[model samples]
Target: MGEFELIRHYFAAAPCAQGGVGVALGIGDDCALLDLPAGEQLAISTDTLVAGVHFPAVCDPLLLGQRALAVAVSDLAAMGATAIGFTLALTLPQVGAQWLAGFADGLGRMAARCAISLIGGDTTRGPLSITVTVFGRVPTGQALRRSGAQPGDLLCVGGFLGNAAGALPLVLGEREAAADVAGPLLEHYWSPVPQLQLGERLRGLATAALDISDGLLADCGHIAKASGVALQVNLAQVPVSAPLQAFLGREAALHAALTGGDDYVLAFTVPESALTTLAREVHVIGRVLEGQGVTLRDPQGQDITPVQRGYQHFRETP
Candidate 1:
């Protein structure tokens, strides 16, 4: 079959997730038609994963498919946007049918799960990198941003601090663990699920929002810097997974949770009055104080030193 046919059969149209909107034209058309629903403003984001850079080399194609899309879609989640559709730009050294099949399967599965569609994309020859530009829509002027946080709003995290950081030891062959632990760590590294539903729910509730891609402390610093307020995180309140605790020990675990990247969880802020209204698993880790730094607090709320900073573009090590 031709390239266009392959895309049409495998990667073109995906069923809507929440039935929020209908696609006027999905695939096999000169251009796609989308109806921007009333009261919603379109939110757009793009991300690229390079080979042996953002992800490990020789990983599962399916998992790679999942991770690539998840990371791109995460921007929408951070902004409290309901995912709509995405375009992909895939580069390959060679288009092996088996590889394309696996990649398409993985991408299709994720699109279905997220209720998104593959509106359009391009493919070419290269060293196997993927770029995804995803779009979602939320009510006008209500989508979350990094600058909305205030001095008195409470800071919270959606889930555990760092698993992707703790899992890297196994990914790089630098450390070993029991099979049970290894499996989960690798899973965390391979497949990161975007928190679309929770982010949508946080729209009006959260004063500001951003996802934890670049470590908790660093990402918090992002909110702090953007919102022009000092943000303090309490070490005692930071959540770490059991596998991370067993693998890295308490202090190192906290470091990974603080400086380690790729947790993909939502770290957002809401007024103190909304604290009790939070869902079952969400944790209120700190409060937005009148300051301009991302520091940690001891149990008594005194400042503690942070060991590592946020992710850097050129740094070889974190």
Candidate 2:
């Protein structure tokens, strides 16, 4: 089929592309337009997923669709912005009716879940890759930032960590487990729910925040550097799901929680005074200190930061 026909049948005609709040113009237009309310600022983020690097070259298209958009929208969640719309640039080796149908269904599913509309994008022939650009909005001065953390604030995460890392083996067919064990891990890996509500709730409360796409240690380092404060992560306080522990053992699970990437949970810092309000929503894993960089503490409060923190696209080799 032709490019326009493919897009029309698979994406442009999809319910998500119908346009919603803030999306002034959607597909078929030269450029999509977004209209933000007065006193609100536009928030945007883009994520690209390649065939082999980001996901298995061969996998379920449905899950891939959900994952591609969810990961991108997580950035908006990190900023505590309300999701508005997104554009998809899809590159394919060749067109397949079944693949496009499944992918579009998954994409629409996630868009509905996040309440974000599909605006516009482009299609090209190439190695399979999907790039999604998400748009959101936040009050002029209330967006969460990585540069606002302060010493004496408690460091927290929205939910349990490392389940996605634990699911890697399952994702690649390297391991198998009972449905009870594999279900949660695979769900986390394939369909991570962005902590949008928590982020919005933290607008005025969280001093600094980000979604944990890299390992906790590596991503926390971003916060520390941006905020110019030391983050003391208490090893004992890091929360890991029981399923992860059951799948990888306690020690291995703990290691995954600390260093495994793609968790996509929100990590933020809030002062002691604001902790009460957030006590139920977050897990207190550490505190901010007057210094620089991330310091991981053992049970005895000894520094145990690992040399390998997280994934990077390109890194120097020794």
Candidate 3:
């Protein structure tokens, strides 16, 4: 099939195109249409994943499909937006039916789970890369942002950290791990669960919120910088999974949780008064302080921000 045909058959016609909640119209048109409730605003985010730089040069097409969409949608979750639809721009070295089939299947699975629809996009010839733009809806002026934090607010995280980072060695083929340890790690890396529900629940409760794509400390820095408040993170309170500790040991796991990126968990600031109102499980890591920048302190209160902040795209050698 030709380019347009390929997109139509494998993408626009996929299960994700079945018309989701906020999609007014999807695919087969000059532009897909989205609608927001009278008092709601639209949330949008874009992300790109390049082969070798983002993922292994040769990786499972299925997992890549899932990862690409999930990564983009995580932004919406950060804003406490309800997922609506997405557009995909795919670049392939060459067309292969098997690869496309697997990718479409994976994308469909994630779309169905998130209740998002595929809208419109493009496909082209080039090195392997995928760009996804996602849309979501949130009540006007109620969407979570990084600039609303206040002093004395409790800092919290949606779930465990460092599992995706712990999987990097196995993913790069530099190290080997047993199934019990590796399986969960790889799943965390490939299929990160976007905390959309939790983000929605936190809309009015969280003073400031963001999805932790970079390491927790690094992403927290973004919030601190945006909000103009100092954040003190308790190293002992950062959540790490038991499986990650078993595979990499507590020290390594701690390091991973501190500096390793791509966890995709949600981090937010909750007022001391609103803490009891949160219905979701979250680890209270620290509190917002009146100052500037992000500070990491061990149980004994020693400063230990990593010498390296986190992943810097062009700055860090791929």
Predicted structure with the largest lDDT when compared to the true one = 2
What's the ranking of the predictions by lDDT, best on top?
2, 3, 1
lDDT of 1 by residue, 46-153 (tens): 999998998776777888888888888888999999988887889888767777777777787778778888777777778978999988999998899999888889
Spell out the clash pairs found in candidate 2. Answer: none
Judge candidate 3 against the unseen true structure and give its global Cα lDDT, from 0 to 1. 0.87
Query: Model 3, range 148-244, lDDT digits (tens) per residue?
Result: 9999999999999999999999999999988999999999999998999999999889999998888887788888888988888898998999889
Cα lDDT, model 1, residue 3: 63
Candidate 1 vs candidate 2, lDDT winner: 2
**Against the hidden reference, what TM-scores do the models get?**
0.90, 0.95, 0.94
Give all candidates' CA lDDT scores.
Answer: 0.80, 0.91, 0.87
lDDT of 2 by residue, 1-318 (tens): 776466665688899999999888998878999999999999989999999999999999999999999999999999999999999999999888889989999999999999999998998889999999999999999999999999999999999999999999999999999999999999999999988899899999999999999889888888988898888889899999999999999989988898899999999999999988874858999999988877777799787635553333111121
Clashing pairs in 3: none
CA displacement after TM-score superposition, residue 158 of candidate 3 (Å): 0.5
lDDT of 3 at 194: 92
